[model samples]
Target: MVARYLVSPHGGRRAHPDISSALRAAAARRRPARIEIAPGRYEETLTVRGEVELTAAEGPGSVVVGRTRGSALDSFGSVRVHGLTLVGREADAVGCHTGTLTLDHSEIRAHGGVALHARPHTSVTLRDSVLAHGRALFTGGTGLVERCRFTDAADNAVAVLEGARVSVRNSRIEDSRIHGLRVSDAHAEVIGCELTGTGKAALMADARARLTVADCVITAVHAEGIMFIEQSRGTVDHTRVTGARHGIGAASGADPVVRGCVLTDCRDTGINVQTEARGRFEDCQVLNSGNIAVFSTDGGAPEVHGCRVVGGNVGVAVIGGARGRFTHLVVEDLTNTALRVFDEAGAAFAHVRVERCSSGLEVRGNGGTTAEVSDAVFRDVEMAAVAIGGQSRVTLKDVTADGGVLGFGVADEAQLRVTDSTVTAVSGAGAGALGSGRLIARNLTVTGSGSLGVYGTGSAYVDLARSEFTDCATAGASFDEEAGGQVVDCAVNGTRGVAVAGNGRVDTVRLRTSLKVVRHAEKPAGPPPQIINIFNGPVFNGPVRDIQVAWGNENVVQNRGENVRNENENEADAEADTGADAETGTDAETDTDTDTDTEGNGSRS
Candidate 1:
């Protein structure tokens, strides 16, 4: 049997005048006790040491327990408080120390301290309650907070520290001065919750904390919606973050896995991974980001897969010696480059598609930067589909670029190797090498170019083999202004202009069908242009011999045998140097001007 006691402010029959007298009488009993209080104000602190239940004779908001200092209610054993309002001015409203405390349908408010505090070895359950200030769970404190409201917190709404385990479900934490939920060196699970209007990040996990958040909405935060730092690890799935500074941030070696999340209208980057952090984002959508959709810097190596980024300034950026692997990514309506890798960074992209962007992929650095793109498609890009500069090296295989201003733009001593790629419907040259850049293309095809199909200028070099150029408005292959290279076993057909034209040295061997070389009249003071054509065409095998032509003041055509025909007017000073080998030549001139663009060079922003 349980002992029952009634407490009333006014003395009555068999009724205690105050709660202290009733609790004193119940303490003498050997059984559990129940204290029923009338609807009035109780201005005293209480401590419970045995099994007890405190109830209001009426319902919630009918009883008020107010204190000026210290906790209004402290529990050392099993205690239950229902339908009562506990308010404290300078201390915690309710505290549980080495005991179990259950609060249901109650209101706990603190003016200058925590609203609810659970010390080590304590278990607290807050259901359908409201916390005005904050709640803290220290080491070894376990709790369940369900269907609760945490509002106007002086600090973080809920803080779990020192290995505490807590679960918050179906709760609303809003208007927090700091983070809505902070976990340090602990484990927390937040499900089906709403965290809004926070001063800082909505959820922050640091000091190697482990967090699992699912089906949550975090919006209108001042900082990152969710942040993981200091080697913390977590999994956030099916979460939506809107109107935050940054949607998610991981730094200082933190490695979190975020999947199936939507981040929209972020003030900055949707996902920021920095400081050697290696996070993985899968099947996520970032829309209308103010800046880059995903940014990884400072040695951060993030893997983004199956993600869609729409309406951002830049889709993904990897710089500051960081590396990233982005696969199956679709980026659209970006104002800048779809993917940018710089500052000695390295990146690999496969099965990626970029559409309606200013530029497709850019790889630039002082040195030691590399990028590989394979099985990628670039459509409707405003600038070059692939731009490489600043001594960076890039390779493209099995890639297709359509409806771009330039297919590939290489500059500033950069090296680009393209194999098994196709460039079509480009407004500028299909591939251009400028400012001492080097290009090596094999088995490549370029069609429907407004300018030359392949061009090398400004002391650049291009080695083309087994390539095909068709429907080019300008010459198929051009090397101008001291640029020299070799074109072997290539076919140039359906060109509106000549097949080859320039003032640079070119060695053409076994070119398909007929070949036309046009030399301009005005040439810079340099070595004379030379062309060594060694042709033994089985298709046109009738009486054509090797020809060597060196240009000196006029168009030149030299025939070694009587059967060969001169397609251009033979000049007096032109020479037929048959001893010159088509496979060997001196190095081209070194150009110091890095900003000069060729006639069909792509524009750089």
Candidate 2:
């Protein structure tokens, strides 16, 4: 089946058009062929109707397929255009069939209309070809481009319109005003390419397809770096994207995984997952952005792990009914909230985690919803280390809030819990040793504070068990209006042990430290509640020295606040008129406030 021909536009004067025409005729005669054109300029349109092999004497810059009124070649099955230049013309340059079209070592330049239009069943491969200054290459079937250069197309440079799977490798697609590569309802793989310039996007996925851009440099885009408009899942790995409106954006359930990439200098969110889209960024460096580094909104959950986020308005903003989880992430140097989980009206933050932020963690709530926080470390925070309000539930376990303005703030019926943790050297008001909530603190240590460690306002209850308080200006446990607390087996080594407001109660509290004056606005006409110390360590100073039990008040300090009429080595030191009538009785309701001057007593029940 060996067939041959020649096409020479100069009428066989230089062996180009004559070789092409002869090859076309031979291919039309249904014979397998190889038509090699020598170095010459062809000014006529070339067409390969049958199976033909059209090659050049040399490579791209060697053999020139010059301008013609029509296309260079209308190829069919197995039409190979290698090492040839298809220059600008008035009509379509190259139209092909559904078979394999291998275009390599060549340059396909400008055109009045379409550049290369592959038919429905064509499988094209372009290797080391330069597609520059053209309308675009429209393809319907699969296209594989390796080491190709696509530059300066007014429209989409390479449009995969219908169900095409286009894979590009080691390519440079730059300097285009429109999309560098636009794939609608098609799959694309862009690997190791430089997708840059002032284009709309380096890559745009419009429909439900899969696109993977790996080990690529996508920078300086006009609008966005890469966009997944519909249900497209794009996986970008080892890539660097900078100077774009949005580094990576997804809409309508676009699940994208960005791994090991450097996304910087983005005008908007570095990674925006919108409309039920899911994104994951692993071991990436995202910094110096104008907006939030990663913003997940509209019912999306984007997980960021082992990433460094710095120098943004917000490090990671999870708002508008979206949730974000940060595991093993380092977020520091933020202009606004490090991780803001904000919602309005019917929206809420499903889940968020600030395992360890460099500064602190701020949580806000709206519309009868709250925020939950735990297991974090705060250092040198400008404001409260953990601010919980608006009916929020914030818990801190094994947390160390060091040198913050406020260690923890609970307002508006917010709940806080600190377990096995320490708060040291903080200089602020309101909850140092303070606040109102169901504050459950166990095995806790509060040292070197400016104010009280646990102070509360309004019906707040504090339970301290095996907790130690040291070196505070105020009492170790201070309660404001109508608050009740219980301290069991706790050591308070401060200026005072307990200070209670009007009608406040402290039960079974052992104050081994000083028992100072409880400042009341007006001494209650009725007997105020007392502090019952069960297992007394030692009365370092005078106990309840400011109390006058003569005004219809009787038993102040009981043995264990248990029973009366029993002398169980638990003595109440009331300086009554008759010191001889001070009998040890098990009266649990005794209004007698006792100061046990006798120290070193054991087992008072």
Candidate 3:
């Protein structure tokens, strides 16, 4: 049982040449031990209790356990080393406790401290190894590192603490001058690894650590290239992060479940879930980022699905009191606002698509912020394609903004609710309710606007009902008189001049409309715009009560040209002494067409 313990008879007689007298003559001959060392330097201070086999033949200076002042292999029992080289400086180059530290094709270089020093319930195994410039390599216990290589670690190059349990496969953690894999109340399994230049955070699992990263490739991290803070929970799959500052970072109350990741460039905010963290990101790809590419703030509740963001500079920024759920997203080409909801944040995005964005979707905040979008699309937007200002609140369904310049902008004191929308080819104002704003739309459609395709002025409140406005160059629903709105059963064909314009003091109100000369001469036996210009801007039959029609008995609603203009003439004896409903003097007016509905499509002025 002697395959060269360097010229035999070590525990069978007495023959010891260096290696600390052949490990004290194989620990006073208490059994199992085999040492076949050939070519050189073993200034070793080795000490093993039970079984040990330190074999070597050529390679890595052929068996050098150098100048150790303390630990250069001080296992309290079972140890196996094949092709050894523990070039220690002043300490630890392997020191397991109730030991089992196996290393094949070994090498533990420049160890000034910990280069494999497992403690409680020790167990360390590495194949094709290299744990360089150490300060760490399994500090607490149980482990396995295959195809290993952990470089320049002055501290933390694989450190699993307390309740330790580690497993790393196809490894390569490079240039770590600090933290390149540190799991806290431990349990980590990184597969197909490659983490580069970590001066911190190139995979850090905090407190209640339980990490499982799969198919990883993390590059150039100076911080946060996958970090989960306290209360940390598991799972991150198919990861790929580059140039980190924050490429996948979850904070304090962490609860992770990320999948299919690919985060790029990032100098800040590339997928960061905050404080009360609770994450769940799927099919991620956050690119270019120099700021804000998905950031859920303070009170986090992150849940992003089917994500994709390209060229970030504010593409998804939910602030402080965050609560999120971004679904089926694709936020592209952003240099600014592409969903930047402010403070008291509460989010919900479904089936989103925002392209070539400069400003598409921004719900302001004075706290109370809220945003909800469904089946969205904002294309080639260059500012204000959905911007609801301070005191925020926005809700949209089936939203679409094509080639926008300004479509849908509600001002300070904000609140907007749109349903079944479409804002096409806008140059400006295809739906805008100014300061003190409040807009409630239903079945909206605004096409090719160069101005005023739905505009309500200051002290605003616009309620567009069953809307549709086309080719507007001037007005297709313009309001003033300290704007207060109500445009019902709307329809404006091609506008170039006043198609439903209401001026000072009329407080803007319309019912069952179809003007602009009956949609430009196509079938105009005209008789449906009932009250001249049907409540078009500028004095709707003024004198106080203001343009409230549908009480026909004398039929004098004008404007067939030829200079005819009567506009709400006395309203059927002033609404038959208030009995109302002469078409609609306002009994809340029902049937504009089909199944009765005067209010409740959504209201809150």
Candidate 4:
């Protein structure tokens, strides 16, 4: 039915009174019916049952369908509407009934209720159209929305659910009272879209939904910018988000991958991966966050690498039995702790640098917690830097803590192995060990402290070997009653008080005291216990040094602490090349921070 009708105001000669009647009579066209109506307001409930094209008789934006009681159109077959304005009240403008609906250069303005809704297996397409002041499109099938504008929508701009596949490209949605784009048990692809002033998350995927958002900009979201929860998975690529509560979040077994995104000025955590979820964040820059910049918690293990987090209250906090790995990170200028791990959680940090924070690197666990850390550098912290407590067995290697009030503190039942490290406390002390903890500081240098270099109390054992301490106000190192240690080949200078004071047996051989010369400390009166060089206060009373003395060239004499020693003149002379390298050799700084009750050999039950 190739028909043309003129409206009342536009010179009507042979015209239909209503668009619905014209559409019904024209449905018998072999090809799609083409009915051109003049530009005017028509009042009817149009129910289309066949393929038809209802075009404007004059031009675009001139045909109007107004004063509708229910939906303007109920489509059961393919319907294409061009250059039309549909204004409805208390009902949807277009309801698709198991058919395809296409709108071009159109506008749907509803007072109350949805603008367009498609049932199961029904699709909808909007090209250069606007849906405003309504609960916008709900898609249960494939939905394609391009170059559209959705504004002041009371509910979600687009809801994709029930196994639908939706694509929205080059669109803009603003001031949505609910979520801007919501997907549940569906898949959605949003590209080159801008969403702003959303009351909820700009994009939300839940209940096995798989979503991908690329080259999008979202701002002023009251909730998270992007959310993947309830076993959903998504990817956000090259997106920019600002002024949201949370920038991106993955929870409830969701595994989202966020790559090449810039998140700034979030009210809460910038990136939150929680609830046993495993997310990957790569090449992201998160700045000026109100709370934690990156948070991995609730037994989740998120991998964050090559990221920069700056100016948050706390940066990169992993809690709630979570385990994660942070590599090649640069976090700086935080108001509080830069890296915090707590609540039976573990985090491995490699090649991390933290600067200008109140504190840095706090690892805490109550009963069963552990972690491995290596190659970390902290500088210019105001409060204590690197506080480890609460029964956590942490291994730190090649760490440098410089210029802080209290350099490091280990308390409770924590076991910390600080190896190949340097601690410089310009205003305070270095390494406070308390509460029956075990601290092994090997090959470490502590310099320029205003107080004691190492303070240990409450049965804590402080092991020092091949370490150097200088410019101390009080004793170089002090241990209270019941604390024990062995300091071998350590150089200490400028201690105003006693060089070392403790009730435990301390063996100081070739140790430099306040006199700036290497001398043996006079052994205490009690007989030495029975252990050999492993240092258990007094373990070896007999001749502990082995005497298989076949003397050789000094250069070829490779003497390790595990080797049996002999006291021949040439061998003794060869051993005296400061004999410190054996105890100072690098112990392998690698261990898993987990909740299992496994020993050092890493056997899990």
Candidate 5:
């Protein structure tokens, strides 16, 4: 099937001294030639066999192949090289081993080692090519680079060694100093690529490699955006990795699978699996990081779903022999310990959530481990939202911690179970620091706490039911220094509510709630002149608990028409209880202010 044959570098005749001796005498006259090569310097080395074809009379920088010393092209059968602009090369500019070598829209620049060196069963194809100044010792071999663009490559711009299987699509491998994409004992398929200006690892795999990266966009890398060493196996999807120090680096028996990725501005860890590594991250988004965003070690098994670990120094860092499982996760800004379970690790958290954090969770010195935190939500934590040290076994259900200073801190025999939770606005000091414990909280709600909401230090057995504690400054429920706790249908608001000092055993707590006192207007006796409630409780019906004030004489003279005749006799005593539900208590009124008390008058004191 002789379809065409036309070889020229200028005139013909065993082809002249120009055009690489007339394209090496029309490709040694095996006859299927298409060697064009016009416009410029062509130093030498253009070895080809039959079925030859080398074009570029005008495309890339106008057909220039000026390799002053070594290889320009050492292709085999069925070869096709278009739009050429291959300059200085001392080693490999193009060295296909067998057949089918096709490079389109080319420009292979200055090289000491490799620009392209396909060996075993070669079928190299590079499109829209541009492999810049590459310095190498087997830099790029088994190739298939589409929409190619590899800039300033000093070492390892692409090296798919050992039983190679490489395929990079929509490429843009930027300025590399060391490793940009080096798959060892290879198998790679990086799609929609953009391995940014890297100095260290933009992509690297060792021994048992099998990488499958998709929709990629890896940013400025100095260390690792994707690295799997030893027994490697990687898979990153819908990726986006920002300035990296470490975005995903699995060591040893690696198994990485991160989906829907976004690891932002990292300096240390966004995802690091060490030693016998294993990983799985889905729907990920890890923001501003200085340290750990997700780390695991030796016997690892990392599994995180619907993840988001915001501004971090330590968001999710599990140490050696790590094991984890997190669902619907959200670990917020952490300066230290957003969720850190060190050493002999084990973790399992569901519906996990945590907000503005300092220490949302920290179970250090873990052994055997067991943390089954459920339906979690911890907000604005500054100190302790949860801190269990050592021998793990923490089980918290329907957990919710708000504005925390301390929510749960169990030190020694860390074994806890908190059900249906709601710990709101816990202020200042240690609010609930139960060490050496066993707590079972039901329908709990500890609001505006200052000192202790529930503090049992040491040997304990707390079983709180229908709990509710409001605006506390000092003690709400404190089983001080150990032992017993069993409270049902509880409710305590403010100063020294329930304080069982030391050896404890408290039972009866059923206070039916009924107190609405609002009567204060003395004033002119000194300087206490404001008492404004305006509309407190029962108005029509008679559950009127208070508002008592009957002081006679001594310059006591009220104006404003005697304060509307004392609220029209308390609204006719709330219409005598309004028995038939006649919109009961519909006209409440209680106001006694001589002048002003700002904040626009909706004040509660």
Candidate 6:
């Protein structure tokens, strides 16, 4: 059985005049006690020892317990307080040490110290209560805070440290001074909570803390909405963060997984992974970010999948020797490059779509940057769909560039290899290599280009094999200014200009019908002179022999007393300079003429 005691300000009929007298009277019962206080103000502190139940006779907000110096309530055993208001002026409102304390339908306020403090070996549960002015500290205990309101805290609303375990549900922590919830070297789970107007990050997990935050709203935070640092690990799912400097950040070897989250109107990057941190962001939406939507730098490599970035400066940036992998990503309405891999970084993108961006993808660095893109689509991009420069190596497979200024641009000692790709409806050359860059393309299709289908200049090298060019406004292929390459088993049809035009040596073999080659008037000043080797002379419309043009000599070789007329007579002379037999179609030996095949069968004599 339980003993019951009643306390009233006016002592009457089996009632104690104060709660202390009542508690003292009940303390000798050697059984569980229930103390009911009347509607009055108690200006004393109470220390609970045994299992005790304290209730207000008139319900919540009717009984007031206040103190000026010490804690209003201290528990060393199991205690339950209901329907009361506890206030402390210069001390903690409630303290639980090696005990279990439960507060329901009450208000706890402290002016100087913590509102509620749970020390080591303590268990605290706060349900449907309000905490004001001071924070709740759990140093080494287990706590459950449900349906609570923490407002105007002088410091972090709630802090879990020193290996404590805490669970906060359906709570509102608003207008906090520092972080709303700080977990350091502890474990916490926060669900269905709203944290707003915090001075710093809404929730900060550091010092190897483990946190799980789900179905939470973090808004108007001054810094990162959720930060995981110092090798901390956690999972944030189904959360929404808005109006923050950065939505989520992980640094210093911290690796957190963020899924099904929405970040909107962030002042800076939506997700920032830096300083050797490796995080994974999946199925998240980042909208209207001021700068990059997803950024990984400083040896940090993040895996992003099934994410969408709408309205940002740069969609995804991987730099500073980081390696990132992105798949099934969609980036639209960006003002800058959709994907940027720079500063000796490497990245791989698969199943990506970029629409209405300034440039689709850019890979550039001093010497060690690399990128690989496959199964991608670029639509309505204002600039080159893919740009490579600065000694970077890039490869594109099964990619489509539609309605862009240029399909692919390679420059500055970069090397690019493209296979099974299509460039259609571009305003400039379908593909170009300049400034000592090298381009190797196989099974590529270029159609509806405003300029040459393929272009190379300035000591660049181009190797095209088994490619097709149709409906190009200029020549199908052109290499000039010491640029040279080989085109093997290719076709050029429906071109408005010549099939091939260049001043450098280009080897063309096994090309399809109506093939034409035009040499420019200016000759390159080096060895390996300008030469066009047409194997098996019957492949052309007329009987034409292989033509080798020496430096300072403009001529077309004659075969069987017939001249292969130059299509553009104003550009270069077509007369035979190398004496050949009019009947046998054999040319005289010259120092530069190294052709050993005399017969028309494309074999050495």
Clashes of each: 0, 38, 7, 8, 3, 0
lDDT of each residue in 1-605, candidate 2, tens digit only: 66755554555553434655575467567877777777777675666655677777554576777555667766777778878888766666777665778888888886655667777778888899988776445456888889988888767777877777888899998888788888778788889989888469778887887788899898888887888877777788999989988888887877788889988999887888778777777888777778778787887777777787767766776667776666666667765556555552121222223322333554445533334444556666555555544444556677766774456655445566667777777643224222244567787777776555655444566666777767754455554445556666665565533432223354534434443424331222323333332111111111122221111122233332322433433344321111112111111211223333333333321
lDDT of 1: 0.79
- Report lDDT (CA) for all predictions: 0.79, 0.62, 0.71, 0.73, 0.65, 0.80
Give the residue spans of candidate 2 off by over 4 A: 1-20, 38-41, 64-70, 88-92, 135-140, 344-359, 367-370, 429-444, 457-467, 473-491, 494-517, 521-605
TM-score, every prediction: 0.86, 0.75, 0.44, 0.81, 0.42, 0.85
Once superposed on the true structure, which residue ranges of model 6 sit more than 4 Å away at CA? 513-515, 521-605
Judging by lDDT against the true structure, name the best candidate: 6
Q: In model 6, what is the error at residue 7, expressed in angstroms?
A: 2.4
Q: For model 1, how does the per-residue alpha-carbon lDDT over 1-605 read when each residue is reduced to its tens digit?
A: 88889988987888888777787787778468899998898988887768888888898888888767777888878889988899877787788986899999999988888888889889899999999875554566998999999999998989999889999999999999998999999999999999999999999999999989999999999999999999999999999999999999999999999999999999999999999999999999999999889999999999999999999788988889998999999999988888888889999999999999988888888668989999999999876788787789999998889986678767778899999999999866688776678889998889998666887776778888999888876567766666668888887778365566555376777666343444431122323222321111000000011111110112224322222324563342233122212222222222121121112222332
Q: Provide the lDDT at 426 for model 5.
A: 64
Better of 3 and 6 by lDDT: 6
Off by over 4 Å in 4: 1-11, 58-60, 470-475, 493-505, 509-605
**Can you write out model 6's per-residue Cα lDDT over 1-605, one digit (the tens) per residue?**
98999999988899998888878877777679999999988998988878899999999988989867777888878899999899877788888976899999999988987999999889999999999989999998999999999999998999999999999999999999998999999999999999999999999999999989999999999999999999999999999999999999999999999999999999999999999998999999999899889998999889999999999788999999988999999999988779988889989999999999878888878778999999999989877788787789999999999986678777778899999999999866678787678899999899998656887666778888989888876567766656668787877778365566655466666655354555442221223322333221111110011122111122334333323445575344432211111111111111111232222333220
Clashes of 6: 0
**lDDT over C-alpha atoms for residue 360 of model 2:** 54
CA RMSD (A), model 4: 12.9
Candidate structures ordered by lDDT, highest first = 6, 1, 4, 3, 5, 2
Any idea what lDDT model 3 has? 0.71
Model 5 lDDT-worst window of ten: 535-544
Clashing pairs in 4: 370-593, 529-538, 529-539, 530-538, 530-539, 530-540, 531-539, 531-540
> How would you encode candidate 3's per-residue C-alpha lDDT over 1-605 as one tens digit per residue?
43235523223344456666666677778677786666667676677677878777465446677674666777787878887887766677777788687888888875567787788888978898788888555656798889888899887788888888989888899988777888998898899899999888888899988999998899998988888999888998988999989998888898989998899988987889988988899988999889888899989889999999999687888888888999999999977778877778889999999999777877767748899999999998775667766678889999998875566767757889999999988765577776577889998898887655776665777888778888765556666536666677666676254455454322223443334321111111223332321110111121011111111122333323243324543232222111111112121111111111121121110
Model 1 spans with C-alpha error above 4 angstroms: 513-515, 519-605
Q: After superposition, how far is residue 360 of candidate 3 from its true place, in Å?
A: 2.0
